[model samples]
Target: MQLTTFTDYGLRMLMYLAAQPEQQCSVREVADHYGISRNHLVKVAHRLSQLGFIDSTKGRGGGIRLSGEPASMRLGDIVLKLEPNMHIVECFDKSTNCCAITAICKAKDFFRQANQAFIDVLNKYTLSDTIVSGKSFLEIFALPQPTNPDRHKQS
Candidate 1:
């Protein structure tokens, strides 16, 4: 299933924060790094902060940082929180479902199973597991190189 831009941006924000555990980053910084809309990232950051996924501070010398350890942040949990709904078919939403075959659609069951499998696979991994190497990510994403590469290294 295709994820909404909101969830996609939320995940990107988390990954960015996970990579720079020692430094707080502004929403604009993340937006610029990913070449996305700053306004959109602002909303994403705000939601993430509200959800306790990131800690945000305002005013001078204030920014955002991961609130919890990356290794302890399960990808499935993150996705579940960020994703508004996991409906894969029209029959999935009971309130709005108007499909003619909803009564006998075995496809809905299969879709549900497939969706659960997707989440189950994601549940097996944590944020830390997704980051093969922060340095490589920085290089690949064209993010600014830290003054001290050693500082960004995972311990």
Candidate 2:
């Protein structure tokens, strides 16, 4: 099963915040550092703030920071919340039955098991746990920049 960009960015956003535990990171700063889209990060930050993962403050010297302890924030829980409809296959959705033999499909149960296993693996690591190493983490991921040079420039 593939995660949507929303979930992908959500995780990255959390990782960025997790990296700077002592500072209040602005959406713009995080976007600039990662070369990610600030617009998209805004949405992710807002949702994360609403979900109690991050806190936002307005005014000078104010920005966003992680609310709860990172260890307490489970990756699986964040993914589940960010990704509302995580149906791996059409049959996974109750309304859409694409398979002809879903009723008697033993494979469906196996798929369910596999999905649960996937979640279990995610649960094994929190945002802090994921980025505990440092810049090496960033290097390994090869995360995209917020602005791609190939895009049009008004200048």
Question: Mind giving the per-residue lDDT tens digits that candidate 2 earns over 1-155?
Answer: 99987788888888877776677878998777666689988998899888888999988988998887777888999999898788887788988777888888888888889988988999998877988565676564476536568644556
lDDT of 2: 0.82
Per-candidate TM-scores read 0.88, 0.81
Candidate 1 local lDDT, 1-155, one digit each (tens): 88887898898889888888778988888987887789989999999998999999999889999999999999899999998588989888898999999998789899999999999999999988877777776666775544554633557
Off by over 4 Å in 2: 134-155
Clashing pairs counted in every model: 0, 3
Total clashes for model 2: 3
How accurate locally, in lDDT, is each candidate?
0.87, 0.82
TM-score of 2: 0.81
Poorest lDDT segment (10 consecutive residues) of candidate 2? 138-147
Position 31, candidate 2: lDDT: 79
Q: Please report, as a residue range, the 10-residue window in candidate 1 with the lowest summed lDDT.
A: 143-152
RMSD to true structure for each model, in Å: 8.3, 4.3
